[model samples]
Target: MFSFEDYREILRLVKESGRYATYGEALEREEFIIMRHDVEYSVDRAYALSRVEDSMDFRSNYFFQWTNNSYNILSRKNRDLLTDMHERGHMIGLHFALNGMTDMELIRRRIRQEMDMLSDMLGFAVNTFSIHRPSPAVLAENIKLPGILNAYQDEFFSFDPKAGPDSALRVKYLSDANHIWRYGYPDAETIAAHPRIQILAHPFAWTKKGYENEENYRTLIREKYAEMIDSIDGECKDFSPYREGFMGMLT
Candidate 1:
């Protein structure tokens, strides 16, 4: 298994080298791809992502769950690192577990718990949220919940095909976990480049070459960074710093 540090190097090449492409450029060249990752407490993976940020000289959103053992969300080290990343301009969002997907009240309570937990651990309020293992039905139903989904803060849902484009679909992304682009979900580049900000990632996915793995699902993630980074090289612009025009309303 490739360590997270290896992943960092991949990102580094993209940001620092300028050799790495952006979504904007990739689209024009017919090779647009975006590199984003969701870290469920896989410290090694997270570390690699951090390195990638360092290498690229840019920060990408990292969604973390509070229930995993890879790293304790409450650990001071975890808190400090999370806060440090945020302070350094990286985004930190909630990785909501499946249990919290059903009940709005439960979701609300859980959000508070998660936000408070993260705040206590990282010394900041957790606002943004993304659901893990979100099924289309669950996503649509969750959207109907009163104070969950988009209520507390930004809710990250992998594109809901049923909800269609008119709904709150924001970012589009796929998991590279198996060395292949997660073909089941919506296209991430389109979502990222959308009017609203899109958050996407799969920390566990990568190929040895650092480009995206298209040949087969193997254990090489770093190798495909070039292809992945190049894929998004010009398809869209970064939506970081978060535009405030929405006024906290879920449109």
Candidate 2:
């Protein structure tokens, strides 16, 4: 059961391991673990995770995708969530999506545009970025944009060679993508043994209770669609005919 309690236990183990460090701190520490959360969906979920981290006095880098329509980054509710996370010492980063874009120049332009927008919205400079489902070409290029640290770059941290590594770097990388641990479950034993590690957990993969990947996604979709219907109905109350079909579909 990969519930919130499980996550809290992981953090507790990391604290006991005497090797946990934030991504920024890992640069100087010989032995450390970098905790990273990519906000693929549900800022509320991310906020919940942040609270757990806060309880442990731990810090992590949270990357948010502006291109993701699953949650509005600019919405008042989400903006407040981001602010709360930032205030609690979690690093806010831009999760850039390539979307099969091959042009380096255009990619750089888009990167800067989103960085500027996010920084302005957060009222602070966002200095880190990670590519969302990057293509082979982008990975090969390893293009570094100005003024932000690339989370995918080798310069950040090395992965341990033994752990079915993903990047060229020599650090142990563990990921919970699609609500399943791709490498292996990052338990206390695994965490204590590794000198340097990178833990990538998607906020949407976790909930207060255990849920399968498909189930979690379905819940998010239903909630977002319901919210959209409410917004539309509120804006066009006079146009009952236009909303009837949409409301019926939702019901």
Candidate 3:
């Protein structure tokens, strides 16, 4: 988990250290960038990151899951909001939990259903996806593997670290049940050093000027949302990949 301070420090380091030169060079040479987040349990973080993206004038894919208390498909408000976000120019993707899909047919079918539901709500078929809770060993093996993610616009939307070889950039992320960035965690610096673009997911668990405070947390969330919208209003750059499933790793 990465705290706000941790991200700030990373920003500072990237700005000060020349290490980013290579990364920047790669971005220019490759003509692309990376910004990904897996929205597992709730859209709270999705909303937060939307703000962050809006602030930075950046747009990235956000994978959201469907389950009780996670994202109630029954909520018309939620559906409309998600759709509006899509119309506003953000990628709405599936965050699949397929660990129990022993049957390949079942896996594809489930994926289709999820994609259809999300896509329909957003008035378009989603092409991108990221898994929830797939083990690292599995992830590494999956990085390069292929699968049928029916109803998606692109197969590359699937984010799998397991399908490929080991990476220096990927690091251990000790986290709460739902992935969220935690600055309070001590190992954030170590995890941040990894080159793999790791997403920090967090539920809206309350915020604090000093410690956990629900009211203040809610306020911060509101403020951040407003800030994010304002940020997007200023300027934005699209960094989605040109090739369907390719995003460069700073190796």
Candidates' C-alpha lDDT: 0.50, 0.77, 0.46
Error of 2 at 114 (Å): 1.8
**Deviating ranges (above 4 Å) for candidate 1:** 1-36, 142-171, 184-199, 206-251
Candidate with the greatest TM-score versus the true structure = 2
- Evaluated against the true structure, the overall lDDT of model 2 is 0.77
lDDT per residue (tens digit) for residues 92-181 in model 1: 777767663666567657766776677666766566556666656545554433332331121333445665434544433334445443
Q: Indicate whether candidate 1 or candidate 2 has the larger lDDT.
A: 2
Best-to-worst TM-score order: 2, 1, 3
On TM-score, the stronger of 1 and 2 is 2
Candidate 3 residue-wise lDDT at 237: 50
Please give the lDDT score at residue 124 for candidate 2: 81
Predicted candidate 2 versus true structure: per-residue lDDT over 105-198, tens digit per residue: 8988888888988898889888788889877666666667655677766645442334354443457778888776866678977786667788
lDDT by residue for model 3 over 1-251, one digit each (tens)? 23343434443443333322221233243121233456644465566556544554444566677753435533565576677667766667777787665555665567677777776766786765666665444343343213323112122223344433232322223233322334223233643444423333343432222224455355545554554444454444542332222212111
Which lDDT value does model 2 have at 151?
A: 75
* Cα RMSD (angstroms) for every candidate in the order listed: 16.7, 3.6, 14.4
* lDDT (C-alpha) at residue 133 in model 2: 85
List, in order, the clash count of every candidate structure: 50, 8, 25
Q: Which parts of model 3 have CA positions greater than 4 angstroms off?
A: 1-33, 135-196, 203-251
